[model samples]
Target: MRAYRYLDFITALFVVVLIVSNIASTKVVLLGPFTFDGGTILFPLAYIFGDVLTEVYGYKRSRRVIWTGFFLLILATLTFGIVNALPTPPDQQSTAQAFSAILGLVPRIVLASLVAYWVGEFVNSYVLAKLKIATQGRWLWTRTLGSTLIAQGLDTGLFLLIAFYGVWDNALLWTVFVSNYVFKVGVEALFTPLTYAVVGFLKRAEREDYYDRDTNFNPFAVR
Candidate 1:
């Protein structure tokens, strides 16, 4: 298969955002009246990148990037788990404890994130690919926003419920869910213009605006 200049860069960015967002999610942040995890700030960028990837590269390549991200996340979580389990030197015990405090909670968060991300991203890409064909590639905003609305909804709801349903209060759990969904979708809407610019540039530069009309949509198929 031929390689594109920007696909690797975008894939790397996607993975970095995914990892950083998962780590940041360890802290619950409050801004004025709204309360949410720290990840909420940066996580939406991953979805935006997801939209761009599907929009430019088509769903098959996007699937590869998504699975790459999935495995990388698992590797990161395992590495953290190992480091957290190691013995600390006497003087560094406090520092180790701090590290543990931050990353110790990552297992569950990572679990929720991985599951939600896998399902959500594929759905986003698949929907956008179909929308691209259905709309005959017009109305870019509809594909981006439409896919994000459904994808982020699944992501927010599944992540919150799986990670904190029993741990947090029922009302607070739902509150976080609602807030996350709103904020993520809002981010996508806010970035629509930027998305349009990026997608346009990529299509022009690569000379390819892929439509998965005859392509297989199976999430498990790598090719």
Candidate 2:
């Protein structure tokens, strides 16, 4: 395996985004007319990061990174669960209650997050990789934005449905799903230029513009 200049950095950021987003998702926030989880604000960046990884390093490398984020997210969930279950000191009982109020929802949120992210990210990478080859890597924008449009829909709808379907009423659930999906895709569209710049820089600096021409598309494959 060849070493890259920024793969580790990008992987670190991607995992951080996944873990933070899962934790933040415990709260549903309203911004103007849009309603979404607090995680929605940062969660879209994970997709952006995914695009960059697949575009610059290829889907195989991106697959490893995705699994890294997935396992770390599970570890975070376990950590929160263990801490939440521990007995609190008398002086910190109230604080523990507050912690429970917030992070207590993390187990379920993490479950929803794990499922959604696993499926959504793999689809995103596969689409972008195929698009890169089909376009012969000509239109970078198409691959990034196109893949995101599909992946974010899967991610947002699955997560919202699994996490809040029964907890929130149907109306609010639909509203949040639409809001999150639109906002996430809009963010991808809005950041097209920045993505171009980053992808360009990485390709030059790393001397890598990977195309998954003969690579396995299996999500569980360990090649």
- The digit string of per-residue lDDT tens for model 1 on 81-160 reads 99999898899988998999898765567778889999999999999999999999999999999999999999888898
Per-residue alpha-carbon lDDT of candidate 2 for residues 1-223, written as tens digits (9 for 90 to 100): 6899899999999999988887788788998888898999999999999999999999999999999998898788888889999999899999999999888765556678899999899999999999999999999999998999899889888887887788889998888889999899988989999999999999999999998999999989997
Model-by-model lDDT, in order? 0.89, 0.91
Q: Model 2 TM-score?
A: 0.97
- CA deviation > 4 Å runs, candidate 2: none
* Local error of candidate 1 at residue 94 (angstroms): 1.0
- Per-residue lDDT for 131 in model 2? 98
Listing every candidate in turn, what is its Cα RMSD in Å to the true structure after a full C-alpha superposition?
A: 1.1, 1.0
lDDT score of residue 87 within candidate 2: 94
TM, every model:
0.97, 0.97
The clash count of every prediction, one per candidate, is 0, 0
Clashing pairs in 2: none
